[model samples]
Target: MQEILRKGLEEMIMKEALKKVLPLVGSVAMLAACGNGGNKANKEAGKTDHNGVAKFNMKVEHEGKPIKGGELRYALVSDDPIKGLFNPALCQDQSDQDVVNFMFDDIFIVDSNNHLTNDGLAKYKVDKDARTVTVTFPKGAKWSDGQPLTVDDYIFTHEFIANKDYPGVRYPSSVGPLVGAEEYHSGKAANISGIEKKDDQTVVLHYKQMNPSIEISGGDLLSYVIPKHVYENIPMNKVMSHDASRKNVVGNGPFKIESLIPGESVTLVANENFYKGRPKVDKITIDVVSSKNIISEMKNGNYDIAGMPADQYDAYKDAANFSVIGKPAYSYSYIGFKLGKWSNEKGANVMDPNAKMNNKKLRQAMAYALDNDQIAKKFYKGTRFSANSLIPPVFKEYNKDTPEYNYNPKKAKKLLDEAGYKDKDGDGFREDPNGKPLVIKYATMAGGQNDQTLALAYVQFWEKIGLKVELTTGRPIEFQAFYDKVEHDDPEIDVYSAAWGTGTDPDPSGLYGEHEKFNMTRYVSDEHTALLKDISSDKSFDEAHRKAAFDKWQNFAHEEAFAIPTLYRTGITAVNKRVKYYDLVSGSEDTKARLYNLQLTQSKPVGE
Candidate 1:
């Protein structure tokens, strides 16, 4: 162990030496590939190659042994002030999603590698020809309130999302293949005709079209299985605000809500009657801590498990009894250009003719002007690498040769000139195509000091090429309001800075599709729709065919430049040596950080 630690230390020292001795281009190359940060308590490990791409071994660690009855305290990062109630169906942010996972089962268990398994349902089977999935539940399965989890619960879930008056959208996409879900949500039907309750224990879901995503899509179904008994009495539209969602929430998962204090903390105790058997941990306490304070909290022992900020990896990566786990995060973050007006209450973007950002070449020029290598080194501290496309390099479908905008201010200036946006006036900044002074509104979530610094870095990059930008929100906007502006498409928000963690499969449709609520840019085209459909919902059985389709779409999207893919990063979490049986992942679901199976102990069998 001592020898391994020495070698790791030597690597970091050499990396730093290489950076100073090398020129600007060579320094960026060294930063990308020089860390052993993403290992499981150093039991087994991962490696980064010359180009800075991280390769994860993903060997399962710390399991099959548990010391029961201990509270695991965790920390979270939120841009919002954190006062909203928890509703699984309506959850809009990471904090809500993390806590909601304990209050509800994710319906299916997705592993670190995107391999999904049946968790909430007793039996799950699919028929490709029928484009249908049949689901069943065990008789012993009961809600936290002791109500039997029946077909009515599942059916009600579909109905709830389909209810037009219900706030916070999560469906129609999950139910994309469901025969009548869109019709019901659009108020064209009374009920979802595709959902069939064969008996109290069995249900069959009929797909309106071909869908290869039925296996992992069970989570959407799981979101709907709210205790029908607990919610039946309440109005559908008002259910999201009910105490059943937060204060008095009841779930059939391994944990039960013990106490609730919004924005402060939440404590959950193990459920003895959990159908999968009670979890090893007796309790789990989630504390809402500022991202800036997470590193301090971890060092002070206030955070037993916390997302390790990249800038602080060196402080704890080789610390005694601590493991900094890293892996290809399942998500991507970007700077989105508002090509259309988010003109409706449902967060629809109506493409506007008069919109200044309708010029694709200008958006492309901004993409070209970014100093991504600097951000990766200074902002990410070698944990994240620059991304050319929204498709994460972690996925099999990611096309490495996709068109790139690799930090060329010269090319950016040329593009701006070619696009007819030149500095006709004596002022340093360029003007609109019609020669009017141009000021772009750049919106971002309100965050701590680090966030402010990062935002400035972005502004400086655009300013270099004569582009003028102003911060959209006066101050750091709270989390909920920030998304409300982005999603609902406030006209004031032209180019917004944001990040999205991708999901299990390398499917981008859910974010870029015409109907997706999370499509903040509101980017859509007939070609984009057809390509997305071919990958997931209306996909072909041929793997090669789907790969080609994905590759085509990624290249096209890159050229279009609706959003600039900023960084594809690996999430690092500092787990105290005492905390075992957990890992960090990114993507469609929160599988990497599964807390239920987590145990607190010092000893474990071989190969754990």
Candidate 2:
């Protein structure tokens, strides 16, 4: 079995290398700088831990003491919210992920000090030379349904994702070169030889080689244990629409979904069977609120706590009844073009002949025209700052060679002119090399005025350099439809403005890798693939080698003008005075300010 696994890995690595030669593409804790002043709000910089990465914190205070049964209402800031498929295998977007967290627990959770801790895991050991991980579940671990969550459930999560018929996108870059992964994903093998269910409570995973990423990015932290009894019979193609996934999925987390209203809202109840003591709150409801309407809703007391918009911060910061808080979040806002096409059958990421964004010089010109600094100041107040790379400067491995695209209209015009884009037809906008009107189609989400506000700024900047622009402004689609078009390679979209709230792990290949479904940017290149592989799943365990590989990939992607990095965000969450225990402030990773930790204050009057 071990030998078969070894052979499978060897074959996959060869194929991976050959492909590289081708071309193509919030958690926290609380520390406070609280209350309000226009100047005080801007200085709400994230506290840093020992590692130098910015720390995301959670802080809330209520005069009344904690009590259980009240419902915490959160007005979600998106047009279209989650669309079923609540299972870990298919929940891709932030809207779905926000709710998924209540049910599923990751293998590791970064602690206050920026180190990985086995939050849900009982015992985990890594054998560097053997390239293996052995995990044991707590003997009495129970699911929401009161069944033991054993080793089979964990192993089956890997098997399901490795199944070629399964249509989820996270496994490719998230878990690198697992033993037998290629054969398993290709259906050449019935099972992955690297995984072994040693007993009812324990499981073992074998990798092609050892890398530091396994501590966080490997299937360990990424796996969502599935009940084999419930899922084994479901067809892979129908899994997204399966009843179990949409409505009845089970997990070992502290809370469980009592009801989900597709795009409207999600209702959760404390999981009595949870290994952690039942959550302090008895019920929590997340209701969808359009970005344009969240302010009104907050004023009407329709929302207990939600993200406060930058424009509205001044109104709430000094408001005695509101807790306006900001902490640096490990996230980036950017714009990307669709650069390649995906073929499901061939599994090939190749250049699209009809791709509208094929010109690298044009992309660079636009990048040069972007004034991230100006936009950050005007739109974000003090909540955000200019970012030069997709990888924010907060990370230790952030490359110093990252190209900064500071605003330069002259440079933009020069590049556009050199690239043969000229006003041949006597119009203000330039024309392509073939004399076709050069127009960029910018697609963005519709729920918030902020999207349009930011889009307008982008349009003005590009038009200053003589580029014609058409914005997706007439009708706004909900988050679900917006992402569907973006990820499915909607031909109408030339560029899309997007943001990513990253994980504790530094590697971001899940968003940039060719095989990753989340690689919405559609960038494809042999050089990129090679560099990603080296830094993420290096052949050697040497620290210096990995750092060099990381810098190389960072600089290569930036120099190629793959995407325009906008800014790093400061998270803003405002809670009414009555809302208590807004969060426990744990890991500085991706999370909604925990409503599970919330309790209503008995002493405070409604809307106080």
Candidate 3:
């Protein structure tokens, strides 16, 4: 197995190097002045002691004493409201995870080592067949309102989310391995016979086949046990949309929502009667602020934790009071082409009347055009990896053997010329077969400074190949609207940016499989579809088999010209040095940072 893995990795590197021999492709700050007395005061506070080093141990001292309170103030970046506390059903953005991580606990949670362990409410055991799993709740587990939490909560959550009436809420992956779960979720079966209540506190899940991924997915990390008492009375539609439902929903976790101010802030206070001892901090407040203000707020000590994008890391990494940690996120950014528009029914290229991109050779030539390494080094400032595969590197199943498109402008121009795209009218831009200009509009989120910069860089690179590229930017919401309007239902836009962030368990089914709703590029092949199916259903949990399957899929995607991967983001967290008990854990899929192991220092003030 070790040899196989090593060989696979070598193949990956070789393929990446063979793709392109691309063309060849910053700042200081003032020191703060301090008086002798002020320096003495800072030394006394323990703030300046840990400067210039990254601390791995989770211990801290403040003012020559151990601080006890563990209060944290975070900032929200968007206004999407969280609709549910249930994990499989939770679909809100980053802020929702922020609130849910504290308000509710999972059945089996991943520790710092990425190993799954029983936490919160249940102890689980798997039968020899690996098909039947049993769970028992801790005797004293109870909701915030003091009602006993039982097996029924878990069963109800499984049933509710599987119901077709919920539409978008169905998490078939979480329950599909169980007997009758797929049928029930797809509306072909009335109920899931596999879920049985063994007793008051015990539940059993029976599956038709052996599946470890299902077991991982069934655990609390993805499955949040819902409150049966609150849900039983609310109408299904109202359950998600009703204000009363959101206000009164009860959960079993360390904290409870004290107040929520919509787009501004959310406050949570530790639940004194929490089954587990109350969290050390009295409260956690998350305030909404724009990305531009995040660093300034952190510098002034208005916030204790903030997330800085990769491009901004160098500007803030030198701060004496801050620590920066970077890890691979579940997200990757890529450029997708409009295939439907390329093959117009009227047989005319809608965007470029010459239809230069309609030729697969031309598209492949464009794919190998830009130098990804140069982009990563020059634009990303070494904060991100040059992604060659659709699967981000964070996943164990990611195909490291996949070939990468190297940056070679000369090769790109040669391919274009061979494919018959030429400046026929001597206008300095290539033309399609129909004698129309080969100009394309690249769409991106309008106001994001980093995205805009990246788009501009791409435009410059594509123009070198005699391609006329135009830039179109929209607000985040408007950009999504334009994407759906043009790329999905129609094919007016030539290229656009899209990203996918997987959960802890990396499954590409929703994004790459046949009939995938999110496969916006509409690139499909039998080989790619078969590989995705094999990976999804393979039962041995063999890492090599999965990697090989994905490797083939990546090769197919590259040959078919589905999308051009730009960068795989490295998750970054910027926190004040005084904050203690925070550790970065590996494994799992959700990108929101985990705080289960976090605790405040014993001697610091609430904000200090």
How accurate locally, in lDDT, is each candidate? 0.64, 0.64, 0.55
Instruction: Write down the lDDT that model 3 would get.
Output: 0.55
Cα lDDT tens digits, model 3, 60-102, are 2222222565676765433233233323253323334545556
TM-score to true structure, per model: 0.86, 0.85, 0.77
> Judged by lDDT against the true structure, how good is candidate 1?
0.64
The RMSD (Cα, Å) of candidate 3 is: 10.6
Query: Poorest 10 consecutive residues of model 3 by lDDT?
Result: 26-35
Model 2, 271-375: lDDT tens per residue? 998765677768778787755566667766676766655544445555555555555655677778878766686665566756777888888898888877755
Distance (Å) between predicted and true CA of 311, model 3? 1.1
What does candidate 3 score on TM? 0.77
Q: Residue 570 deviation, candidate 2, in Å?
A: 1.1
The true-versus-predicted C-alpha distance at residue 450 of model 2, in Å, is: 6.4
Q: How many backbone overlaps does candidate 1 show?
A: 15
